[model samples]
Target: MSPNSTDAMKTNLGEAGAHLKNAATDAGSAIKNAAHVAGDELRMGRSAVKADLADSALAGIAALEEGGGAAREQMDQLMDKGRDLIDSAADLIRERPIASFGAAFAAGWIIAKLARSGDR
Candidate 1:
C-alpha cells in the first residue's frame, strides 16, 4: 500500500476503536442503571409481600377468635342443660324420698348379688 492509504487506514481503525470503547462504556452504565432499578422494585415488592402476610395473619386470628367465642357459648349452653337435669333429679328425689330410698336399697342388693356371682 502507499503511505497515504496506510495512514488513512490507521486513522480509520483508531476511530473505530474509540467508537467501540464508547459503546462498551455506555452499555456498562446502562447495565448498572438497570440493576439499581431492579433493586428498588424488589425492595418495594418485599414490603408488599410482608403487608399481605400481615393482613392474612390478622384475618386468621379473627377467625380463630370467632370460633373460640362460638365454642364458649356452646359450652355455656351445655352447662345450663346439665344444671337443669340436676335440678329435675333433685326435685324428683325430694318429692319421693321413701320411694327413692327403697329403690336405692334394691339396686344395691342386686349389684352385690351380681358382683358375688361374678367372683364365684
Candidate 2:
C-alpha cells in the first residue's frame, strides 16, 4: 500500500476508537444517573409508607379511646340502675314485714321439697 493511504487509514482508525470511548463514557454516566434517581424514589416511597402507617395507628388509638369511654359510661348507668332496684326491694320489705316473712317461709319449704325430689 502507498504511504499516504496507510497514514490516512491510521487516522481513521484512531478517530473511530475515540468516538467509541466517548459513547461508552456517556452510557456509563447515564446508567449511574438512573441508579441515583431510582434510589431517591425508593427512599421517598418508604417515607410515604411510614407516614401512612403512623396515621392509621393514631386513628385506631383514638377509636379505642372513644369506645372505652362509652363502655365506662354504660357501666356507670348499670350500677345506678342496680342501686335503684335494691332500694325498691328494701322499701317493699320494710312495708310488709309479717307478710314477707310468711311468704319467704313458704318459698323455702317449696324449694326444699323440690330439691329433695331431684336428689332422689
Candidate 3:
C-alpha cells in the first residue's frame, strides 16, 4: 500500500476508536445517574413511612393520656364516696353507744371483706 493511503487509514481507525470510547463513557455516566436517582427515590419512600409511623405513635399516646385522665377522675369520685360513708358511720357511733357499737362492728367486718376482695 502507498504510505499516504496507509497513514490516512490509520488516522480514520484511530478516530473511530475514540468515538467508541466516548460513547461507552457516556453510557456509563447515564447508568450511574439512573442508579443515583433510584437510590434517592428509595430513601424518600423510607422517610415517608417513618414519618407516618411517628404520627401514628403520637396519636396512640394522646388516646392513652385521655383515658388516664378519665380513670383518675373516676378514682377520685370513689375515694370521696368512701370517705363520706366512713364519716357518716363515725357520726352515728358518736350519737348512740350500744347501737353505735353494733353498727361499728358491722362496718369493720364489711371493710375487712372489701380489703380481702381487693387482694384477690
Candidate 4:
C-alpha cells in the first residue's frame, strides 16, 4: 500500500476505537444509574408496605379493644340480672317455705325418674 493510504487507514481505525470506547463507557454509566434507581424504588416500596402493615395492626388493636369493652358491658348487665333473680328467688322462698320444699321434692322425683330411664 502507499504510505498516505496506510496513514489514513490507521487514523480511521483509531477514531473508530475511540468511538467504541466512548459508547462502552456511556453504557456502563447508564447501567449503574439504572441499578441505583431500582434500589431506591425498592426501598420506597418496602417502606410503604411496612407503613400499611403498621396501620392495619393498629386498626386491629383498636377493634379488639372496642369489642372487649362491649363484652365487659354485657358481662356487667348479666351479673346485674343474676343478682335480681337471686333476690327474687330468696324473697319467694322466704314467703313460702313449705311450698318451696314441696316443689323441690317434686323436681327431685322427676329428675330421678328420667335418670333411671336414661340408664336403661
Candidate 5:
C-alpha cells in the first residue's frame, strides 16, 4: 500500500476505537443513574405503604371505640327499662294483694321448672 493511504486508514481505525470507548462509558453511567433512581422509588413506595397501614389501624381503633360507646349507652337504657318495669309491678301488687300473690306463686313455679331443666 502507499504510505499516505496506510496512515489515513490507521487514523480512521483510531477514531472508530475512541468513539466505541466513549459510547461504552456513557452506557455505564446511564445504567448507574437508572439503578439509583429505581432504588429511591422503591424506598418511597415502602414508606407510603407503611403510612397507609398506620392510618387503617387508627381508623379500626376509632370504630371499635365508637362501637363500645354505643354498647354502653344501650346497657344504660336497658337498666332504666328494668327499673320502670319493677316499679309498675310493685304498684299493681299494692292495688291487688290476693291477685298479685297468686301471680307471684305461678311465676315462682315456672322459674323453678326452668332452673331444673337447665341443670339437665
Candidate 6:
C-alpha cells in the first residue's frame, strides 16, 4: 500500500475509535442520570405514602375520641335515669311499706318459679 493511503486508514481508525469511546461515555452518563431520577421518584413516593398514613391515623384517632365522648354522654344519661328510678322507688316504698313488701314477695316467688322452669 502507498504510505499516504496507510496513514489515511490509520486516521480513519483513530477517529472511529474516538467516536466509539465518546458514545460509550454518553451511554454511561445517561444510565447514571436515569438511576438518579428513579431514586428521586421513589423517595418522593415514599414520603407521600408516609404523609397519607399519618393523616389516616389522625383521622382514626379523632373518630375514636368522638365515639368515646358520645359513649361517655350516654353513660351519664343512663346513670341519671337510674338514680331517678331508684329515688322514685324509695319514695314509693316509704309511702306504702306493706304494699311494697307484698309486691316484693310476689316478685321473688315468680322469679323462683321461672328459675326452676329454666333448669328443667
> What is the lDDT of every predicted structure here?
0.97, 0.97, 0.96, 0.98, 0.98, 0.99
The pairs that clash in candidate 6 are none
Best by lDDT: 6
What is the lDDT for 86 in model 4? 99
Best by the TM-score measure: 5
How high a TM-score does candidate 3 get? 0.46
lDDT of 1 by residue, 16-102 (tens): 999999999999999999999999999999999999999999999999999999999999999999999999988988999999899
TM-score of each: 0.68, 0.63, 0.46, 0.66, 0.69, 0.62
lDDT of 4 at 68: 99
For model 5, name the residue pairs that clash. Answer: none
Task: Give candidate 6 regions above 4 Å deviation.
Answer: 1-14, 84-100, 110-120
Provide the RMSD of all predictions against the true structure, rounded to 1 decimal: 3.6, 3.8, 7.7, 3.7, 3.6, 4.0
Candidate 2 segments exceeding 4 Å error: 1-21, 94-103
For candidate 5, the clash count comes to 0
Candidate 4's C-alpha lDDT? 0.98
lDDT of 3: 0.96
Q: Which should have the higher lDDT, number 4 or number 6? A: 6
- Residue 100's lDDT in candidate 6: 100
lDDT of 3 by residue, 21-116 (tens): 999999999999999999999999999999999999999999999999999999999999999999998888788879978877999999999999
3 or 6: which has the higher TM-score? 6
For model 5, the run of ten residues with the poorest summed lDDT: 1-10
Clashing pairs in 3: none
Candidate 6 local lDDT, 49-107, one digit each (tens) = 99999999999999999999999999999999999999999999999999999999999
- Model 6 local distance difference test score: 0.99
Candidate 6 lDDT trough over 10 residues, lowest sum = 1-10
